[model samples]
Target: MTTPSGPTVPFALARFATDAGSVPGLVVGDRIRPLSPAELGAPSLNEFLAAGEAAWDRIAALAAVASDASHSDGTTADAAWRPLEAVTLLAPVEPRQVLQTGANYRTHVIDLVAAGRAKDDPRPIEELREWAAELMDRRAREGIPYFFIGLPACVVGAEEVLELPDYSEQHDWELELAVVIGSPAFRVSREDAMAHVAGYTIVNDITTRDLVFRQDMKDIGTDWYRAKNAPGFLPTGPFLVPARHIADPGDLRLTLTLNGETMQDATTGDLLFDIPALIAAASETMPLLPGDLLLTGSPAGNGIAHGRLLRDGDVMVGTIEGLGSQVVRAAAARVPA
Candidate 1:
């Protein structure tokens, strides 16, 4: 339905292993709004999304009123109305847990080391030390160094803008491919791991760049988690498109623009570890459940280290080839005067 602000759409709220259902929703001027859960034949918000694509049709019907306005190019005549900004964009999935990979892009690694943030060898220092003696004996080999983690509170949604806290000065932005789990999977084979995927969306893994590098030493738990999990660290979506539609996860054209200048531009192929490898490696340990999220990491050329950290009123927009785009405003953590 259309609100005084603009046309709206039924935005879905997804969950796993729970009775929550999708709620009726509308996109009122740049925001995704829930119409009413009960009206969609579901008891709870998560339950409605769990109903699957069929429910999406019904949810789309909720937007029928707005969509019928006879406009060109999937937009309406109201220049001031942007449905994506009006409603509170909730994380589409209720991930039992969230897992992310570090330094998965080959070019990103090269650039990182050039920037003096990462070591040249992907192997950990301890492993390097162990292999040093063996190298003298002529049997040393290099290996990929990967870091994985379960970031519980590092979740937010499409419409929400992140607040950079005062205590931190080194804020950063990472544009990643966020995968939503569709089924329960554990130690799944590469071919099968993708079957567990629910869909894909964009993720801006906002990081505290200074904190990331300050605690860059080995074996010690840097307060990176706290800095990483700060409120609004992760902002995702405009919507989640089913995997069936994305023919090649590795070929998508991705771009990140800060304020208005393009800051990062690269394809998913730049990834050192492709999507399947990441899925297989992650599932080897934790049981990935439907709605669980995985962030595929970002590429080279981000703010913070590469450029200037984001500032108040700075607008960051992330766009993927097929997937829709999302915009975030960088405002000081205070009520605008």
Candidate 2:
């Protein structure tokens, strides 16, 4: 299919339907061009990304040539060009490891702390704000990024339905920018971190609020596994935009709407620890492998902060500046009698 004359996006790697089944494809405008078996070499997106930087460069070059040819021909229809809507969009890549940052956004942390303190303190809002600001400042200066492991079994496609666990009532949404690793990283410095990133994708880190803290074992602290690792808890990807396409990861906007009402709207600029810092911190303990995902923490205005948690039949639309949007439906978890 011929494309319109404009700035051609090199490629937006995606997995879509083909005659044999779903395969990795390169997205150009509204159509998808399935990667041939030879081109794929690797069976899955995970393996494809792990094939190294030269592999991605080759794909991008091939995509650029096709895009240029399409522009020159100006043809609108081709058998190879399938409309994006017609194909099933799967999670761009199945990461071997999923690591999520906790309390990485300044405003998100401030809001939670302020709300918790408001229950006991008689101070005014301004006073609380002042105290919270000081606390965050100190944390930024002294604290390192806190990260937790996430199970890859919980990941689902962009349009997948999320079954709210029956054990929890306060299901919530946490829209975040998920970083995709291109190369292995071990105890890497912040200066060399960007080189390891393949691209960016959106991940809605759905959490069950009531399950976050272990009531019976307070000393153990948060139980992210139970609260977050439910099947389909992570709705990820419509596209994995190449890191080169995004000018600055720290400057993108993130927003989420529940049933058409905007809930969380913030920018990566508010992040207390940016991508490079988060990468460095996470790699300090373990190696970050190719196709691994690092979820930068969500911004403020989550269900806990707004008192409007997710409910069955709710539709959440999460959007990040250049990464694209994800629409997921909430369903009641079925329990066997």
Give lDDT tens digits, candidate 2, residues 181-249: 988899999999999998888899999888888999889999998899988999888788888888999
TM-score of model number 2? 0.91
Models 1 onward score TM values of: 0.72, 0.91
Q: Residue 63 in model 1: shift from native, Å?
A: 9.7
Minimal lDDT window, size 10, model 2: 1-10
Query: What is the clash count for each candidate, in the order shown?
Result: 27, 0
Error of 2 at 247 (Å): 1.0
Candidate 1 lDDT over residue span 1-337, tens digit each: 2111221223333211113543334443334445555555666444544555665576556555555663766676535334553344456555667887787665565555445534556876555545543432231124432545647566766556688876667788889988887667799988887777757877888887666634556466445575587777888665666566578999988898887789889999777667777788788887877677788888877774366887777788888866667777776776431
Give the candidate number with the greatest TM-score.
2
